[model samples]
Target: MGIDLEKGGRIKKRNRTAPKSENPYLLLLVKLYRFLARRTNSSFNKTVLKRLYMSRNNQPPLGLGRLVKLSRKNADKIIVVVGKVLNDERLYHVPKMTVCCLKISDSARARIQKAGGEVLTFDQLALRSPKGSNCMLLRGPKHAREVYKHFAGVAVEGHVKPYVRNKERKLERARGRRPSRGFKRKPKKV
Candidate 1:
């Protein structure tokens, strides 16, 4: 007797019906988006709903500097982000525009308002643009985590980062990584 799965013990689909957070505010937003997604035919609403179900790690924060560059082309459209907006000190000058996001840092909010720009929440955005018209959706780089740099086989073999627990010189320069311990590796013939 054995158990056989339909997908051969592998499933690559999102199965979340709702967010895992019990935060009342977040739950309220989820409820609002759920209705909007069901009632409206706009794919934007569906996309927003899907992002709302993502975990905290998946909801990466955006920076003010990159945002300015992203909205440079379509400055009039409202910028939408499903994560926090952080202040980037590199951005000395801010531009006037409308932004809608889940969270905003103190400095970022101050800078935006000082530049004659307005910040909005998801609910307010829905009231203004029910169908998500004249809105540009953006997200932070999800693979920006340091662990991604340690991944191997996807790129150059020698470029993968190694975990070093000690700073001692003797601990390194040994075995497969060094030529003195054994036969040195050679590049493959082209």
Candidate 2:
């Protein structure tokens, strides 16, 4: 489909300051919780919507865009998981907690190191880190299995490549209807 420009556009706030009087349903829930707390005369922990996982079938994860935004702001480390290898274009928009090997050239390595990053092999990345963890998993190639084993907890980023739209052909067809003037008309024979 179209380009996903919002992938790395914004960072998430660690502590969100929610509206005191928000959605009606949420308000009702809050009131109910408050009623319970008051009846018991003891405070209760509020409901929190944490991690939501998405299937890896032929579709991109739902709300993955939000996760990417969150990771950039809060994650300490990034690991890139690439099926085959990394490349120049991919590293341009490097998110935290990634394990990619597009190029893995000296310059790229240097740049990553300079940014205070930890370079790990695909296998090393697949090994799951501890819970309450903040990381991003980048799967670019078909060989994601080798690296998918390590990480126990991770936030997957990037949208799956959707079907391509042939815009150029559409434009060409549209242009054909217009008439073209000829400058090379032959002079009439006397």
Best by lDDT: 1
User: Which candidate gets the maximum TM-score versus the true structure?
Assistant: 1
Off by over 4 Å in 1: 1-12, 153-158, 183-190
User: Which 10 residues in a row give candidate 1 its minimum summed lDDT?
Assistant: 2-11
Q: How well is each residue in 21-101 modelled by candidate 2, as lDDT tens digits?
A: 345654443444344434543221121111011123311221223333445664665543322222353334544444332
lDDT for 108 (candidate 1):
95
Model 1 per-residue lDDT tens digits across residues 53-121: 999899999999999999999999999999999999998899998999999999999999999999999
Alpha-carbon deviation at 115 in model 1, angstroms: 0.5
* Regions more than 4 Å wrong, model 2: 1-71, 84-103, 127-133, 139-175, 181-190
